[model samples]
Target: MPHDHQNDEPLSSSGHPFRADDDTKLSYWQVMEIAVRELLIEKGHISASQVHEQINRMDARSPANGATIVARAWTDPQFKAALLTNAGQTSRDMGFDIGPMQLIVVENTNSVHNVVVCTLCSCYPRNLLGLPPDWYKSRAYRSRTVVEPRKVLSEFGVEIAPDVQVRVHDSTADMRYLVLPAKPAEANGVSETLLANWVTRDSMIGVGLPRAPV
Candidate 1:
């Protein structure tokens, strides 16, 4: 006997199967965000176009932007000094939209290597480096990076010498960190653009070294 299975499958208005996005309901905060934005627009406190533009600007930021900053710091001593002194101001001066978040730039040297992690949550430098990687937000990374940083780093293929110290910095909601990996020797005379390409996100996170210029 043929079964009447038509009702078992859920379909959209146009007779297509519903997508995962359609099946899932909006989250509480998501609904609240929409309501707040709409209310602000209704009260003329903010314009929709302004909101759109801001979203676009945030979406445009990525690791490439941070890489460019790193490249500039590598080539220019003054810029490097300024960056090390005041990371947030230096980034804003360079036209990055880091908002009001406090950014700390740690430099990797011959004797010290710095790594950043958010044990409580994923407090990342997203405005400059885009979204944090999955591992960065994982429990293992958050907890292990603080406890056994050297072993965690080793798993990522970054082996620090016994004599060299590994320093771990915990990122908070108000403060974020960016690791300035020691510039590769091969990148000494490279152009800023080329240098930027060699500066990987993992390098900036202190999990790996900058790619050698080929």
Candidate 2:
């Protein structure tokens, strides 16, 4: 069979999100990788390789897990305490085992304050928080998150009192952080699911927090 090399190129098909350019230097590495991987699969160099599928399924189910976690924290006082003390423990208490990178949450209350940053490098907590967005890791975020957290937070629609001290953290290791922002006064007794919907990723990053529905 005269196989069309170009047609049957990237990862067993076309329409892959990334294209395999044959002309570039990367093509050599790509071809080598493809050949080695296929051979490994054929020769049982690896066992049943269903990891990709499992990973896909895990990603698909992330929002539900996040929602469940968010709701419980909002409704339960003790649970919220646990989350503030140790974010990793809070995730586990909910029957969801966060692997590692034990997350520690800080609360922004009347007197105490907190801000999250990645100074040396971005070492976000991947267990409790899957992955930080592109912007979180950007130089701009790292630079500004520490200097003027309130200003940046305002961009995300959070307003801070002038008296509060913004304590910025340097994420130098694998440890990540999230902020247990003060519950909006209007959201008291809100359903867990509804409250969870209000908790946005930006809130966890300490840039923003959930709000009562308008």
Candidate 3:
């Protein structure tokens, strides 16, 4: 999707989010990336087939991978410890390469709530959770999550008690975070597969919780 380059107006005259700029205008990096890719293909340095394969690999990843890990952690104490200690290796053990980026798994407890955000950009644990949500990449979320996490989470319908402490984690290019949301009370006696189904993409991102099974 194309990003608008409007700087002055908060909202457009139509009362919608301002996107009055020309859609065809490309950012410097976007132009550079296209130029570089075309140059590489032109020189036969990399084949178009290789690029398509990489794109397919990325598209294959989804929240189910992260949810599987979370479900295991919820049921097995040892695995949970291993996940918290070395998230990268744990993910690799499950056949997911999290690349060189460090993955930090934060546990949401009864007294403490955890939320993750990348203030600079949309740095996320994409290897396990696929892509970051559009709202996560929004400037408002990146800025507001750190300042008023409780209120921000409340806006997402994730309410916490006044006594509960909210810890907001800032993800960077070198490191990313995944939230291990507290297992729902109703999830007791549920199979791991079913439990995995209960987890949502937003839950791993800490913007929401796992859905209760109907």
Ranking by TM-score: 3, 1, 2
Report, for every candidate in turn, its global Cα lDDT versus the true structure: 0.90, 0.70, 0.87
**Leading candidate by TM-score:** 3
Each candidate structure's TM-score, on Cα atoms with residue i matched to residue i, is 0.84, 0.72, 0.85
User: Model 3 segments beyond 4 Å from truth?
Assistant: 1-28
lDDT of 3 by residue, 1-214 (tens): 2335455557666555755668688999999999999999999999889999989888888888999999999998999999999998988987787677688899989998889999998898887788878999999999999999988999999988999898999986688899999999989999887798888888888889998755
Off by over 4 Å in 1: 1-21
Better of 1 and 3 by lDDT: 1
lDDT string for model 2 (1-214, tens) is 3344465445434444355557745678888977887787788877445646656644654434554566677688888778777777778767775676567777778875677888777777555556667888889888988777888878877777888777787877766777766677787878877887677666666777666545
Model 2 spans with C-alpha error above 4 angstroms: 1-48, 61-67
Sort all candidates by lDDT, best to worst. Answer: 1, 3, 2
Please report the TM-score between candidate 1 and the true structure.
0.84
Q: Flag the better candidate by lDDT, 1 or 2.
A: 1
The sequence of per-residue lDDT tens digits that candidate 1 reaches over residues 99-213 is 8878889999999999999999999999888888999999999999989999999999989999999999998668889998899887778898789999989989989899974
